[model samples]
Target: MSKRCFLIEASNQEATEGQIMTVVQSSASHPLYGDIVTIVGKNRVNDNPVIISAYSKDSCHLEAERPGIVVMPNSVEEVQKIVRLCSSTKTPIMPAGGRNGICGACLPRVTNAVMLDMINMNGIVNLDEDVMTITVEAGMRWAELIHRLDDKGYKLGFRGPYGGNAATVAGSVSINSMGYAASRFGPAPEGVVSLEVVLPNGEIVRTGSGWNPEAQIFTRYSSFADLTGIFLGDHGTLGVKTKVTFKIYPKAEFSTYIDLGYKNLKDATAAFLEIQKRGLTEELNCLLARESADTYFPGLLDSHPEINATIHCVIMETDKQLAERKVQIIRDIGLDLKGKDLGNFAAQIHWAEKFNEVQPMYNNGFWLNTCHLRPISRIPELMDRMRAIFKKYSLEKNGIKWIADALAVDRAYAAAWVTIFAPTKDKMELAEKAWNEMLDAAMETGGCPYWSGLLWEKRALEKVNDTFIQLYRTIKKSIDP
Candidate 1:
């Protein structure tokens, strides 16, 4: 096969040497390329093969049908115009953010779709300290938003996902991402004050307090039916989120990190649930099994091979005394559960290198991630079932690796991130089979995934109540169709 090399742009930023991928062909002209260029200027649009392949898949192992063209819209007006044009031409349009999603959420389902690269639209629209709210263009990255807020002595309740370096505010919000301070503030949508969305029919709609033209965009529960929720976690099926208003908080003055080691998963899970219930941490994550701990921390457990699981907690407060009190309470709960103080290395490293840490794990193998939410008390049952599945598939014997981990979210549930590593291309098929089985097992155990995208969409839909699915479809069709 004839091969061509192209430097893939990193989230609409500069191309890096590591991003150079070998694909076929060069730029191919599209029928609507001229129209798109006219809307967003020629420089912001591309019919190039490199851009096509770059947008063909997210961080998932699967690729979608290649898009015919990619358009970068820098403003709400430009997005509206492009959507109007696509609607009039009956062309499928897919709005994409940083493309950092692990699932196939941003990929176009059809070959002739127009991929909207929203990166160019990144800009902070407003920062209102009076109301403790920040209004920003949907394309703004979480890391940028956090730093900007930090400089202003404010922070978001739920900061962002672990991939905040490349994950966009709107992208994470749209998928209902749970990370950072999720243990305290719930998911990203919980912090949303309002949203400005461009509907499928090329009409603009503002939700929450923005529903009233005269009201300030300060609350999500106000005005009529709380329509802002219609778009949250919709995975871009309803509309394109152009602007988002988030509730911000004053930056905490004190913070602490703690790590606890347990001899078994049950004790670790018990301590994790207690910490979350007592609201002692801003962030809480636990490795449910020895393999998972080894996967994340490597030889850290070498000296303590008896420890089968570990918990990391991050506490932040405006008062030093309060923070210290919370830290002590967390330690007490862990100790009561027969846990050992493992120091703060894991928690500190996780906090300091949030975005950079996850990528290095790819060096182990490609991930078949079955990430979802479940009750914290069920971690032991789920872990046992997962082990059974791994044994059934002879995963370890075949040289494949897996991790069973959970992150505390809200008050009662944990986001279970069960992952299988396909060490090589030859193991991918087997890994996929095992992954599907695991997903089924998770669903049977009352696990609910936040992001569907292409990864969990089919499986999730299958498990969803028919009435709920119909209601969602009804709303989706009423707005889009």
Candidate 2:
């Protein structure tokens, strides 16, 4: 069986450049006849994968390392045909969005599969200012969406962290992404007003219609069943998302970022819990010593080597003088827990410059890696337990320290993270061990890991009751079987 790849470019709703050269096939082609096709478009690939080749670099996030066959489906019908062919042939069809996933969830694991690249289907269908929602093809990048929305003084919920330099809105939502602004607007799944999916059997379906004012609340299939929810976090294992409609919010007038330090995790978390209760701040992120600080702010390590605990940060947006008061509140609360007030600043220019710098190391040739755990309230007690496990593991000796940060989802919830500095090759193993231990710890506290980290190993999978895999299987069977 010969596999082929094509570089497709769509223009005027038709396959133009590279796609025209490759022969479309239903099954594996002859070695001499097979061609490997890659689809290239603006905002279609990620920057990291681009380093390998100009083809990977130029395309947005949809890089396929051993891409068998790259087919760019320019219209809904084209996508449907591709899905149908794959389903009938039992070929593993991988849908390419922006390929920014750290866990390789978007890429097809099965060999001799077809890659249905969706970067070409990006057409703006509607922008209802009154309704405060926009419908666009699934291939539109968040950066493009942000630019389009900024013209109307609107912004979508937090762009997912997998939201690469050029990740698309559809790809982010397909994986149920959570972004930097999660504290304010929640995850990308929260912003989805509707979805247009091409099922495995080549059926076209719409999740919700913003135009329908009488749309049923949260129902996807029957009035009692939610088909959309089943596929929301399915990680593209269900079907290819062709279009998405999500809500947007007005841009904030003022935004400030304050960085603070605590004596230890206990003191910092105590303050974080209380500040969350007050509900004055817009977004707060607590980066444990290993995660946020090491990835984004490495310079701090050189200056304060002994500061091996945790750093707390917040982005508060408001025109009121409440900025200073909010700082005071955080300080006071931390003080009660015997935490030290590191410093505070209210500089708009500075904060704006640093606003989208979550993984600053990406610009400097380092892979900006991250994973989401469960929400905070359910994980704090578990985090304490994990800390004990870390102590027993003694990571510092291996030059591997677990840096973590968390955001308060509500008064009773917090989502904590752990960042490990190790070789990429060893990361999978370490993450496997850490995740299993973490999952066990979290389960003890009745918390589950985030939706994005659904690709982890058996131990972690067991913690979530194989929900991710089961969801994928159910959707695939329904759509394909």
Candidate 3:
């Protein structure tokens, strides 16, 4: 990959490197810098790949202003202490976990910021089967958690996103990711029972039912006011997640797959909504455009009859018969709409290798994805607008491909459109134009785009209720001030 840097701020020009390093040297001057916490100046911090990797080194592909100082803290106490030091110095803090997110929200927007590297704080705090919840430190990985739960005869309510193994629990919850298990259990935030949040001022507060003295981490929406929702998708703006508790479920007795092809995008989305309305599928993981199918699953794409779209369904139930019945319903719906049964053979094969399937859809390289979530009734409208944007920009011929997921028929399902292309100057410009138009249409039509904090928050909120932006700004200031 070509290495290019876009300095996000002028703080570097205003303050010299020596002046920046002074912040760290000054922090170690405090007596609170204990054995569990280590402070590194710009020289040492920039040299360490692990810390830098968490900043802008992974999949997000955006350049972050290099922090003047980096702090490594292994425990919550150390985390609080580090936060206080940054607070006292009035340095902006950006928190990170696993370093695998493609969304640029975690990157620092300004220079001289301090990064809260939470990797070392990973530890399973408790597993209360009696309460039917498990508590883990914020830095724990989803891949490990899944295996751990299964080892003890339990399962999570949701699957991590395709990159779940590389994404942290706190990270995914912060984004409220809609993943493979969304149709079955709900969004990532739905499974979160409580949060142990380190406030901007370094105070640790517990939310959920645990807010009271009972200490049982099972339920959300305690008798008191629920503050947990405030942080569910905040992207770590309000505070740092120290610990979290999530609801769990029994392992499904049966899991099955089915694939269907549609002649048009509109019909595929309609079929998906109907399937979702009937609650027949546990997961509608893939809604691939023709180009998407070609790029991601060439073999399957070759077998299909030049269909414009394809949908992948994952059905699960305790009884094998019931699972098969739901899949049949999906097939019937698809066929009724003049759809083709591509057969479950390809879907089954995809499921077998789904754990490591992130790269196939990534366009073999760089791409931008627009995640739009709205009710099923509006998907066709959104599709028309999205297609127009692509046509206007001639994105179809430029290697751009669109993909959507049936987030839920019962809720606002997501319709994600991705454009894959090499980073050539002309293609990059066109890609930008297409992305902006797609997102604008999404919010204009009562849909919310993904990565709200960074990409679509202002526009989406303004379209819904203009006052919300101000209210959120006020809340942000109130919490961080």
TM-score top scorer: 1
- Clashes in model 1: which pairs? none
Q: List, residue by residue over 32-66, the lDDT tens digit for candidate 1.
A: 87777677555667777777877788887878788
Backbone collision tally, model 1: 0
Better of 2 and 3 by lDDT: 3
RMSD of each: 7.2, 8.1, 9.1
| Regions more than 4 Å wrong, model 3 | 1-54, 286-288, 301-303, 361-363, 396-412, 423-426, 461-466
State the lDDT at 391 in candidate 3.
85
Candidate that would win on lDDT: 1
Model 2 TM = 0.73
Query: Per-residue lDDT for 409 in model 1?
Result: 90
Model 1 spans > 4 angstroms off? 1-28
Predicted candidate 3 versus true structure: per-residue lDDT over 7-34, tens digit per residue:
1122111133221222223343323334
Residues 1-481 of candidate 2: C-alpha lDDT, one tens digit per residue? 1121111223226544323222222233412112222323322222221221322322222234444455566777667766766676677777767666555556555555566667777767666555566677877777777766778677776645534456777777776665555666666777777777888888877775422455422223443355567668777777888878777677665544555566555556666667667765556666555344555555544554444444354645445466667666666676776655545431222234332554443432223233555544443465577677666666555445455667655443555555444434454455446545754665566654454432443445555556776976676676667
lDDT of candidate model 2 versus the reference: 0.56
Which is the winner by lDDT between candidate 1 and candidate 3? 1
Please list the C-alpha lDDT of all candidates, in the order they appear: 0.84, 0.56, 0.69
Q: Estimate the lDDT of model 3.
A: 0.69
Q: TM-scores for all candidates?
A: 0.93, 0.73, 0.84
Error of 3 at 450 (Å): 3.4
